[model samples]
Target: MTFGEKLQKLRKEAGLSQEEFADQMGVSRQAVSKWERDSGYPETEKIIRMGRIFHVTLDYLLNEGEGQSEDLAEGKNEEKGMYVSRETADGFLAFRQRKSLRTGLAWGLISGGLCLSIWWTEPGMILYLVLMIVSVVLLFSVKLADNPYRRIEKEPLVFDEQVKADLNAAFSERKKTAYLLRLTGIVLIAAGILICPLITTWVPLVDDIIFAAGLAAAGVGIFLCIYMTGILRAYRLLMRQETE
Candidate 1:
């Protein structure tokens, strides 16, 4: 019995084909097969890695006749160390921070623009309507930035054992909150649009007052939506830091 026989026995006992074992070892299937067939031997480093992957001692992997526990723990610490690396944690933190800053700046710009439009325009109602539409658009932009489509591609493949579950839970909560906020905004905007004709047509003594109050309520709702979005963004950023 030789190293090749030992390698084949470990692979079979672990329920892995040559290709599957090669992938875990980060080597080619042909390389695994060659090792198993006595055509070649893995380098010292790869042999150690194979031992870890198979949960066997180096002695058992090198000598066919040796027996050892297959439940030996090895790769867990390596995986955890990779996940908690400073660089990876820093990258996620930077991404979340930038997103929060961008959302806050967008809200400020929107609020200032609406104020200016109200002051400068002669028909303030029309300007207010335009501002409502613009605010809705900006909210959509914030949502998009928070979960950029490209992030699915760019996110780190490695996940920290301690942080992985927490990150997933936070993400789920944020998504639910965002959906509710968006739904509320959409409903308010639709109601406002339906009331536009009535506000324009009614000629009661208090029609002007009623119209002004409606516009003010709509404005407040829109602003509230923006404020809630900012809060959610900040919460997400803080969660990211906690995970790190």
Candidate 2:
């Protein structure tokens, strides 16, 4: 008998329907159906699991049948668990890398533009307005970008230990840079807060040029912090800490 036929016979003898068998195997019912119909075969791991369920040896289930032992391990069918492939993981990282820059810039522009527009420069206000509009649009676009891994959000992801290790290493590589940018951002913000007020207190007059310049510097610092954080968040998503 073929592997599927043998599987069907074993499941029937055990008084299990396709759905029950699928549940026992930690797979979808359709996956069980495909197996029984010989349209698909389970992975080598799944085959081993099934052997245990039926109280049969791997040699017995796979014995001398069409030279199929090697072919059976090719997991062409999707399992119940979200088994994330390396390619998918890489694609997601690339997508996030591309999107996060735009996202960070958008937030930076919004904050900086609003702060710089405080002094109400006539022609400069026009420039800030354009930036603000563009920032808002970019933010929305990032939010609505097409995401292929959306379903992964609903389930716990399963991946090879190597994928996990690689992600951890990548995050480690990025953490130092992100930390520096965040520290710099804190310094710049502090300067922005104190730069104008300190001068104003001494002179009893404030310079719009100085205040706007300080806020603008703070904005560039904000951009760096946001950009670095956004990149790290992508690593977190793949690591399965939390979803987006």
Scored by CA lDDT, what does every candidate get? 0.55, 0.70
User: Residue-wise lDDT of candidate 1 within 1-244, one digit each (tens)?
Assistant: 6888878876797566776566555568898889989999889978866654554667666655534444234433333211222233344445554554455445544543444343445676576677667666655766776432132233323443444566566668766876686567556545543573276546654565555445444544554465556556544543443323
* Candidate with the greatest lDDT versus the true structure: 2
**What are the models' TM-scores?**
0.36, 0.61
Give candidate 1's whole-model lDDT. 0.55
- Number of backbone-clashing residue pairs for each candidate, in the order shown: 0, 0
User: What's the distance in Å from true for residue 143, model 2?
Assistant: 2.5
Measured with C-alpha atoms, the lDDT of residue 128 in candidate 2 is 85
- Per-residue accuracy of model 2 over 126-173 as CA lDDT, tens digit each: 888899899989988988887655544555566657766787898898
Superpose all Cα atoms of candidate 1 onto the true structure and report the RMSD in Å to 1 decimal: 12.3
Clash pairs for candidate 2 = none
